[model samples]
Target: MTDQPQGAPVRLTAFVHGQVQGVGFRWWTRARALELGLRGSATNLPGGRVQVVAEGPRAACEALLALLRGPGTPGSVTLVVEQFGAARGEAGFVER
Candidate 1:
């Protein structure tokens, strides 16, 4: 459990590694982020990684992080590097 205040808005940036690109990973991430009421983007990086940024309530963002690391994602995820901070008030989740 995190020490953050319940429902406090936050930003979660996750760099997902492994077979994540060209596999509908961004679209899947966008769906999950939308479902979690987060606003950000899932973008492909140069090194075959997916960078997922989500801003929303702390708990919601954490849930999205968990989903990103879990087995139900579109492709095999070998690693997930995460960073959390204050929310930036983004509008909607997008697949970039």
Candidate 2:
């Protein structure tokens, strides 16, 4: 458990490596983020990686990160690099 207040907004930036691009991974991430009521974007980066930035309640962001690292996601994930911070007041989730 964390000491942060409940429902406090937070940002989750995750760099997912391995077979993530051209595999509907962004779409899947968008769906999951929307379902969690998060606002962010999933963008395909160079060197075969996907960058997922999500902002919302800390719990929601953590959930999204968990899903990103868990099984059943599109393509295969060999490594998940995560960073957290205060939310930036963004809206809507997009795939890029």
Candidate 3:
């Protein structure tokens, strides 16, 4: 857990643009989300983008965001669009 007190759990939606669809971006996102103890799904959109929806403790979700946007990101992921909000209380993380 992070040092700061994150008031409540949250859900994070990220649209990773660029060459993100065919390069295992969804699976990578799922694995990382599950590893972080978050629950959500990663799906490939019609465009060359991957959408990651993660729900968990605020800090964990934030960590997921950092991972996708930082070094943990796949080589194909050039840009990441992130949105945060209240959690939907999902159960497990998966790839779709």
Quality of model 2 by C-alpha lDDT? 0.91
* lDDT scores of the candidates, listed in order: 0.90, 0.91, 0.81
Predicted candidate 2 versus true structure: per-residue lDDT over 1-96, tens digit per residue: 344566788888999999999999999999999999999999999999999999988889889999998998999999999988878888899898
- Model 1, 1-96: lDDT tens digits are 445676778889999999999889999999999998899999999999999999998889889999998989988999999999877788998888
lDDT tens per residue, model 3, 45-84: 8877788999888878888888887865665668888888
User: What are the clashing pairs of model 3?
Assistant: none
Ranking 1 against 3 by lDDT, winner: 1
Q: Residue 33: error of model 1 in Å?
A: 0.7
Residue-level error in angstroms, candidate 1, position 2: 8.7
Pull out the clashing pairs in model 1. none
Between candidates 2 and 3, which one is better according to TM-score? 2
Q: Count the backbone clashes (under 3 Å) in each candidate.
A: 0, 0, 0
Task: Work out the TM-score per prediction.
Answer: 0.92, 0.92, 0.86
The CA lDDT at 42 in model 1 is 92
Question: What's the C-alpha lDDT at position 47 in model 2?
Answer: 100
For candidate 3, which ten residues in a row score worst on lDDT?
1-10
